[model samples]
Target: MDIFEDKVILVTGANRGIGRALVKALLNHGVRKIYATCRDLNTMPSLDDDRITVLSLDITNDEQITTVAVLAQDTEILINNAGVINAGNILEGDLEGMDNDMSVNYFGTIKMMRAFAPILKKNNPSKIINIVSIAAYSPLPSIAGYAASKAALFSATQSVRIELAKEGIAVYAINPGAIDTDMNKGSDWDMPDPESTAVKILEYVADGKFDIVPDEMGQGMYNAWREDPAKLSKIFSDLYYGEISE
Candidate 1:
C-alpha cells in the first residue's frame, strides 16, 4: 500500500516551508490529487499541475475547516503541516505572541484533526501527519511559547494515534529540527532545506513510522531526549544562554 501513489492528499499551510515542499514531493511521488491550502490564497504559489487544487483555509477558523472538509471529502491523507512560531518565553516575553502561537500551532492543528477524522475514517487506511517540532520534547527558552504549543500537539497526536489505531487511520507525528525555511531564517544553524526534509518525512511515512524525527539534528535531539529528558533540557538551556552553539 504505497500511500502517496494515486492518493488524494490534503496539506495545510501549503504556501511555503515544509508544507509547500511536501506538495512538490507528493507530486513527484505520483499522487492522483492534492488539496493545497493556506490561510491566504494569494500567498499560495502558482503550482502548474492539474492534480493540484488551491484553497483558502485558516485552520483556526471552524467555518473554513468545515468547508474544506466538505470540499476535500475524498482526501485519503491529511497533513496538518500549518504552524506558527512566535518569539516568546514564560518570563518577560510577548504574551500576545504566545497566545498566537497556541492558537495556530496547537489549537489550529487540533481543529484540523477533529474535522478530518471522520473523513479519514470514511476513506479507511488513511494517514494524518502532524508537523510537530523537535522543541516539543525540550523547550528552547528563546522560543518557549512555540515549544510549549508543539509539546501540547505532540501529546494530542499520541492520544489520537491510540484511539484511531484500530480504525485504519495512521496518525504520525513529525518532529523536525532546524529546516532552512523562512521561519528559521533568523537562526544561523546550518540547516537542511525543506525539500530534503520533506523527502525524508515522506520516506518515513511510507516506511510505516509513527513518530519521526525527520532530520539529522532532530534525530540527535530525539535520541538525547529518549536517553535523558533532563539532559536535553539542559542542552537547550545552554543554547539559549549562548553557552552552546545552537
Candidate 2:
C-alpha cells in the first residue's frame, strides 16, 4: 500500500527548505489534503493546488499548536519538521539562542506530538515523521546547543516509536547529514540537495523504515559510528575541518 496516496498530511515549517520539498512530493503522490504550516503565514509560498491549506503555527506556542490540532482534525500524517539552529559552544552560548534551540527543536516538537498523537491514533494506521539530524548522534562544538537539541529529539523519537506501535502509528526519525539549505550554510562537509533528501525521506517512509539515515553522508556517518564511535567522535571534535570530513 502507498502510505501517502490518500492520506491527510500536516507539515510544520512548510514555508521553505525541506518542508516545501515535502509538500511538492505529497502533491505528486496524490495526497487527499495537506495542511501546511509555518510560524508566519506570509512566508509560505502559495501553491496552485486546491488540496493545500495554509495555516499559521508556531509549534512552541501552546495556543497555536492546540488551534492547529483542532483545525486539522482529520490529519493522518504529522511531519514534525520545524526547528531552530543555535550557534555557540554549550559552555557559554547566548542563553536566548540556546533556549530557542531547545524550545523549537525539542520542546516545540514535543508540543506538536502531544497535540496530534491522539488525532493520529484516532486516524489509525497513521504515521509521525520527525526530521532529526545526523548531529543527533554526535556533537559539533561549534553548534553544540543545536546538536544537543536534536539529540534530545532523537531519544524522544525512539520512545514514541515503541509506544505508538501498539496503536499502529509508525514513527519515523530522519537523520540527514548536511542538506543544502540556508540553515546549513558554511558546513565543512558536502551538503546534499534538499529536494533529493526530501525524496529519499518519503521513499524511506513508504518502505516503513523507523530510523532512517537519509543520505549517503548520513549512512556513512552511521556506519562509522557503529564501527567505532569513539574514533568518529574524536574526528569530529579534533579535525572536523580536516581531510576526513571532506
What tens-digit string does per-residue lDDT give for candidate 2 at 1-246?
377988999999999889999998889897999999999988899899999999999999999999999999999999999998988877777888989999999999989999999999999889999999988988777788899999999999999999898998999999988788879777665778888889999998888788998899888878878999875587577744563366
Model 1, range 74-99, lDDT digits (tens) per residue? 99999999999887669988999999
Best by lDDT: 1
Worst 10 residues of 1 by lDDT: 237-246
Give per-model TM-scores: 0.97, 0.95
Candidate 2 stretches with Cα past 4 Å from truth are 239-246
Candidate 1 TM-score over all chains jointly: 0.97
Model 1: lDDT to the true structure: 0.93
In model 1, what is the error at residue 246, expressed in angstroms?
13
